[model samples]
Target: MTVATHPLVARARLLADDLLAPHAERVDQAGVPVSHVEAVKRSGLLGVGAPAEYGGAAAPAAVARRTAEILAGACCSTWFVTTQHYTPVKLLAASGLPVRERLLRPLASGELLAGIAYAHVRAFPRVPVRAVPERGGWRFDGTVPWYTGWGLNDVMLLAGVTDAAEVVFAFAEAREQPGLRPSPPMRLAALTASRTVSLRLEGLWLPGKAVVLRTPQKEFAVVDRPRNTNASPAVFGVADAALALLDGVPEAEETARSLRTRLDETRERAYALWDHPVPHERIEERLALKTRSYDLMRAATTAAVVAGGGRSLDLDSRAQRLFREGMFLLVQGQTAEVRRAHLGHLGD
Candidate 1:
């Protein structure tokens, strides 16, 4: 379906034009208001990747990616806060556990927003969080270095590494619980409006049913690698928004056109590798595209800032915001392998 006609895509554009874009500066400065999240919930974009059997739209991957691009371009903060919901939805949909019956429908229907606390899984050999078997359940201890949408999410998919070298992913209420506490939201260089914080899990316990996915660490790595190598759609979204800001400036028009062409080419290659059915195929190509996209994003945002001149430094200016957002996207889904590969590409 075309983006202009797809219900979800149309809703995203509506949100961008009517709500997100108009107040994005204020929202970025003051923080993502509950109203923004409520609007997202009402739009039903949270179910983009969820199974249709559970009341989800389950739109095509291209549509979902484009919707994300629209939302990110309009307001990265709102996108940051709401984007966390999809991971948990995907996990629960594929989990085949009893908790899926209890949580999937509400999550899929946008009745219960979810967030993620699973990035630490990428910190291999470090084991930032540990899970131990306890009274027919599991106990998580250690810290989640970064937990976004702290107060905004109703539930979270918390993950920890087990002593046996397996990874355990489980769901829990996002709020403070018996052994879980959240630091006040962090003051970040960008996307502070997302209400991000660090979580301390001290013997956080969950029944067996709460556990969703349990697999060997090696197996988890095998699954995670391909995902990380691909470019994030947000990179292109922010870049596109910046380019739009330079549309009429003769000095920037040529640069914007050049970067847009490169961005489109890189995105095509990245998505091809990402959508390839053959696992582990073209991984280097994916990483190369990801790094190239980052370069284009930086160029696009810098050009916008230059076109805006001193005015771009204003906190209310979209140029400055998009610049910072680009910086955030650079490291958003970072992994050591991704980092090394990105650095190699930069050196090239």
Candidate 2:
């Protein structure tokens, strides 16, 4: 079957059309409800990239990316919450560690949703969170400044840096516990429905069996840098959704067609680099395409707002939502390198 016809992709489309899109505005204003998350879990889209033996579809990367686009376009807030599940699944699938046997199946099968607390690891020398060796396990102390899907997720893959400069990733129940305290969710300009909060890890301890992956900071950066260089599929998804707003406006027909062509071209180049066999090669090219995608996303979302006229300023406006979401995407997974490159591109 074609990627479009893939079961997981088709399920994503159905979920997007029937549920996510219809309630996106409501969810945006009211915060994403537990029911919306339950619908996603039942749809089985959670296991798109997981191993088949673990009750997952084990679909190709193309299928996974396509599903992400559909969901993000339909409701970026919902997409953001669910998107955190994939990383833990991926790490566990590749790991021979004891944690793999324990959490992989449940996560891959959508029986358990996982959130991530590892992005702060990107700070490197600044190390906001620290992991110190303890009694046959580890002790994590410090703060996770940004943790999304807090109350909604069943577990979290938390990370902290050791004095040896090793990045330690481990699993813990995502809850208020003995040593883990979560701050109230922050109100943001976009995707506030995602339930984002800060985590304080004061002597939070996990057994060695809970550990997933531990790698040297430099080695981790080697893999992580390339991944961040690629354009996020969500960018195209939100852009396409915004362009559709223009397509429906009679006076914006020419503008819609012109922008669609540019978007398609940029998307093709970005994905080609994303799928390249050698991820580490063409680093600059990847960053260039990524920034280009961001530019197009901004333009498309802006056009949508302009076409929307004064109504676009309303809280329920899809155009306004997409525009704010686009703004959020600009800094979503930003790294020093990405920021420098994007700013440099803007300067040029």
CA RMSD, predictions in order: 1.1, 0.7
What tens-digit string does per-residue lDDT give for candidate 1 at 104-223? 999999999999999998887889999999999999999999999887899999999988899999999999989999998899999998999999989899999998899999998998
TM-score of each: 0.97, 0.99
List the global CA lDDT of all models: 0.91, 0.93
Clashes of 2: 0
On residues 1-348, what C-alpha lDDT tens digit does candidate 2 reach at each position? 999889988899999999999999999988888888898898899999999999888999989999999999999999999999999999999999988989988888888999999999999899999999999999999999999998899999999999999999999999999999999999999989999999998999999999999999999999898879999999999999999888668889998898899989998898998889988889999999999999999999999999999999999999999999999999998999999999999999
Superposition error at 103 for model 1 (Å): 0.6
- Backbone clash total, candidate 1: 0
Candidate 1 lDDT score relative to the true structure: 0.91
Off by over 4 Å in 1: none
